[model samples]
Target: MYECAVLSVYVDLALGLAVTFLLLSLLVSGLNEAFVRLLSIRSKFLWAYLRDTLDGADDRTGAWLPAGVLDVFRVLPFLRDPRPRHSDRPAPAQPSAVPDPGERAGDSMINLLYERVREIDHGKRGRTSISDIPPARFAVAVMELVTAGGDVDDFLTRLRQIDSPLYGPLKGVWESAQRDLDRFTKGVETWFDGEMQRLSTLYKRYVTWVVAVLGVVVTLLFSMDGLEYAKTLLRDNAYRASVTAVAEAGPEAYAELRARCAGQEPVACVTETLSQPALVGMLDQALVSLSIPDQGAPSVHWNGGRWWDRVTTPAHWPGFLLTYVALLFGAPFWWDVLRRITGIKAKR
Candidate 1:
């Protein structure tokens, strides 16, 4: 019986952590959406990479790709060039008859790159390369925009000077571009694909940082202390009973919410789950258990209005930091932990 009592305390701690993590995830996602709207941070990375790829090359030839090629990469959101739409380039005329050999020679290197790939006999069943289609077509189109006005080097230099994350790890590729344009173009394609993979990891890092900062702010705002709250729940049988009841009912609600929010992109899914009124009400009920006057609200700040004293207390620092760091582990993690605990409780 004593062992069960101690175990219940641990379960309550996990439940608290799960609730906080969900809140943190929503905060981070909201911040990301705001950043995207304000700065176009996501698209800027692609543009900077494109600039770096075209760095240092001058187009002495007056050749340009057909205006239709500009639309080649429109299907890909990441590769889409945002600069050209805002640039002062004059509108191009529609494609007429095919140009003679000399006129085609003056086309952009990127234009030729696409042409080379198109000339390949796919009947040989050769594996697709970045230059092959879709990606290659998109790359060439964006490259034309990045290198427009023969200012590839200047464009990337400006992006680098601005110190954006979009200029990530492309110094070597740009340096190589100075020596061999073909190799530079290929490296750019490779780097773009590689960066696409890295983008996922980078986004998580941003969210982790956002969650940590937001966790600290929230803890300060609510005067939350993980350790003190745990102790309070353990000492008060009524409070623990209320929490247990809520937790016991959480599994089915969570499962239903999960099913409803499944198949969405990460940001959208988290936003949807966090916004659900049913889930929000469940969390509110659990919080009520912690703050009810008869239950002797776990933290004194709940009853006493000494917000500064609660915020400045040294003993709460460790618990505050613990919550902040746990937030970095993210909501899905705590949700799974709570789910396992609930499963064990169900069996018993």
Candidate 2:
């Protein structure tokens, strides 16, 4: 009986910690998504990738293009500054002379292809930057550019004369197509898909770092100490039991919430999940019960005060770091663990 009671205490402690981590994960995820969207990180990265691919540069410096080549693309309305300008502010002065057409001639093919792709993807909708382009659409744009008012042979000859890094690979793709337009379009789509997969992997790595930084920031902001919280739950049986009971009822609601959020962007999905009244209320209640200083309290100043003291204390670092690491595994991970623990508890 003593062993069973001990096991029950440990299980309840686990449930409480899982719930705490889950709430923190949700907070961090929402903030990260919002930050990424507000800055248009994905769109910026895609724009850069497209530029590098077209210019045949290994990096963003675009050294392959002649001076003033990019200026032509920059002037396009869709490529202009995305930030809203103030009506009261004066317009910037225009350049004294038009960019020499000869200087931009080498980039014309890429420029035309980009414009065609933009028309197909965005249509009448204004877009400052394209966040995504379907492979099929990209293939269509390339084919239209190559075949418009000319034969493939003439286009390939002109492509060879251009000073772009894309010449070699594009030539290979064209040769492999064996003069069949359908085959060439399919090959272009395959090439686009491959490049996008690489970009996606790179973006995922970038997001991982973003999430890690956000985790640490959120942990510090909340004064969340994993070690301290665990000790509190272990010693305070009533508090642990109450938190665990609340968490036990969470999985069903969480599953429903996830179902409803399916296929939405991260920002939208997280916003919906965090805005749920019942979830917010439960999290608030649990956080209020914790020993950490409340954000709304006057003593919680960050620069200097009891809060700083709490932060600077050597013993608190371990807990803070622990919570930060836990958050890196993400909300979905903690949610799965919560569901499993709840199931086990029910069986007992």
Candidate 3:
């Protein structure tokens, strides 16, 4: 019977992850097509122009995949040019150090880079290298609109007021353009240097965050799922309480959760179960609270403000997590980790 419960849990999770991964694969396949069509799109604004880079048409996705999962497809060896060489002449005197800075003095290397990529190949596959897609191109597209008719003042004025994440990065670049077109060209080199450093730092931060998140996700996938099944079993109580309640209880349950978040109930006095986020948060809080043994996997419980800790031993959390991880994803996880750690590529 114990084994049967575990098996049933595995079946549910396999079905779920399989469906999710399949959908992800299909979505990526669609993106492969969309990226090609987008190159023709042009706009005075950089944001609109940035949209043109994608080969796919449909990007409306409600499901958010983690950066790590997305990175696999993003950093695929065959997709991008490893040795990214700029198409434009080298920047005069100093080079634009950004990933693909152009040779132009006052002009955005990003713009020239775009010109070169299109020059290299527009519609044909195996024509232009994929690494040509850099953030500078997006920045330059916006700059083109600003620099039209050589009006720098209006552009800077409007740019400062606009709300955007890129605004900060592009500020120094534009300021360089305004101050010295020749000296500003020198400034462009500086700007590229800064941007490259910024991006590199951001990428490192992203890597650390992604790894920690994967650890947490892997932990939950193995350990808390069984506990989730147990909670589902407990919800059978609400189902038994009243047939009518069962129909209405979902909204009611949410309302009860909101009330708890508002601190209407004392910590120990609450009777209703927490929402998923709150439950996950509680498990994290518990790891710190109880001084529980730390393991590669994290554990969670849905406490209805009662002492459920006695039922689920602190020690069992790691075991359950490991068992689930090993049973469900051990092989694939090990393979991926080995490949990533060793920088080894799998042959196609």
Off by over 4 Å in 1: 1-6, 55-137, 140-191, 198-208, 238-305, 344-348
Question: Candidate 1's C-alpha lDDT?
Answer: 0.47
Identify the leading candidate in terms of lDDT. 2
Give the count of colliding residue pairs in each prediction. Answer: 2, 0, 11
Window of ten residues with lowest summed lDDT in model 3: 40-49
Candidate 1 residue lDDT tens string, 154-268: 5455445544233444456768777466666677677767756654464445445545666666556555666665554444444435445545787654454345446555346
Candidate 2, poorest ten consecutive residues by summed lDDT: 90-99
Q: Write the per-residue lDDT of candidate 3 for residues 61-137, one digit (tens) a residue.
A: 21111125354234322232222233443323322222211221322333433453343333333333332334454
lDDT of each: 0.47, 0.62, 0.39
**Model 1, residue 4: C-alpha shift (Å):** 4.0
TM-score of each: 0.45, 0.66, 0.26
* Predicted model with the maximum TM-score: 2
Model 2 lDDT per residue over 201-234, tens place: 8677767877888998787766677888887666
Tally clashes: model 3: 11
Query: What is model 2's C-alpha RMSD?
Result: 14.1
- lDDT: which is higher, 1 or 3? 1
lDDT rank, highest first? 2, 1, 3
